[model samples]
Target chain A: MTYGLFSKFPAQPGKGDDLADFLLEAAELLERDPACIQYVVSGSDEPDVVWVFEVWTDQAAHDASSEPEDIRTLIQRAMPLIAGTPEQTQLVIHGGKGLPS
Target chain B: MTYGLFSKFPAQPGKGDDLADFLLEAAELLERDPACIQYVVSGSDEPDVVWVFEVWTDQAAHDASSEPEDIRTLIQRAMPLIAGTPEQTQLVIHGGKGLPS
Candidate 1:
């Protein structure tokens, strides 16, 4: 699978929860899009952090979902909610098994 | 740039820090590897939850990193630390800006 995960901290300590909510909402929106095979958004207890994990059939599908103008808004709104910039990674996902079982 | 993000849960509570440590160590080791461009590991306030964000020059480099046996160990050791299976994702980073300040 073409998979990757990343996390971000809100610019302020208290903003984490809000940011988490925002990202979750974004996930709901993104999942509805046909290009998104699977996407999940979650928050950290830190109240200033959030995470994103996503998978796509291929790069083209992933890139297509990323082009909408609303996508930009979703991130800009999340900017201040972040402390530093988000840490991003591209993973091979070698040893993963059943999810949420 | 080719990028994606994914997160994993350790199958148990109170193991988030441990998973985070293991992942960070993995990152350190991975960063030293020739194929890796940028890899960051982080933990959530909720124990047993960890996130990974990675970037690579392309699919070949990422696939190369995914083929290691150690990668499986890095995840297997994290199993008990998680509550269940970790959710994974593939993303097209649209509005991400700077990394650490």
Candidate 2:
């Protein structure tokens, strides 16, 4: 199954540029790893916000990537840059037939 | 339960601003309604990306909102600005005790 997570970060004053750079690095790290099947990083087109769409090959892979202490710390480091608290949800990737693969 | 949708739009060079404004207006419409419990809008800190985090009161409400013709058109209009296709997943709002209400 494709495990998914949606995390949001609010705009923090002048840290917009810094936060963006930090997320780019994070996405690169995940994309470079073999376990990551579909990892997308995005933000609002107009406002100060960040959202990450993550899909791993399976539960085991998702669990492994999230278990790392470094990733945890990276999130912690990025928190303060947010204007509002982040909210997220996870799910089983049921299916997407017509959409791009 | 919170129904979510994560859509990614491939950046269309100059159309970024138009897309962002469109999304903001859409969010405002949703937020003004009572069924929407939690609605968050944010963009990537670095790239041309838009992500929305939405939590509706229930499945019925979520279904109702998306059934509208105008919303569909809005999304269709915004698609061109996306750098890539969007992806998302939904789940039951199991529970969050420690988190603020």
User: Of the candidates shown, which would achieve the greatest lDDT relative to the real structure?
Assistant: 2
TM-score of chain A of each: 0.71, 0.70
Q: What tens-digit string does per-residue lDDT give for candidate 2 at A1-101? A: 55556666666876756676677667656755666754544545435666655656666887787567777888788878878777865644433311124
Report the C-alpha lDDT of model 1 over A2-24, residue by residue, as the tens digit: 44444444447777667766676
The lDDT, on a scale of 0 to 1, for candidate 2 is 0.58
Q: Write the per-residue lDDT of candidate 1 for residues B1-101, one digit (tens) a residue.
A: 44444445454566666766777667766755655644555454444456665555555676677567887778677666667667765443332222211
- CA lDDT, every prediction? 0.55, 0.58
Give me the runs in candidate 1 sitting further than 4 Å from their true place.
A94-101, B1-101
Could you report the DockQ of all the candidates, in the order they appear?
0.04, 0.04
Report the Cα lDDT for candidate 1.
0.55
Which of the CAPRI classes, incorrect, acceptable, medium or high, describes model 1?
incorrect
Judged by DockQ cut-offs, the docking class of candidate 2 is: incorrect
State residue B13's C-alpha deviation in candidate 2, in Å.
40
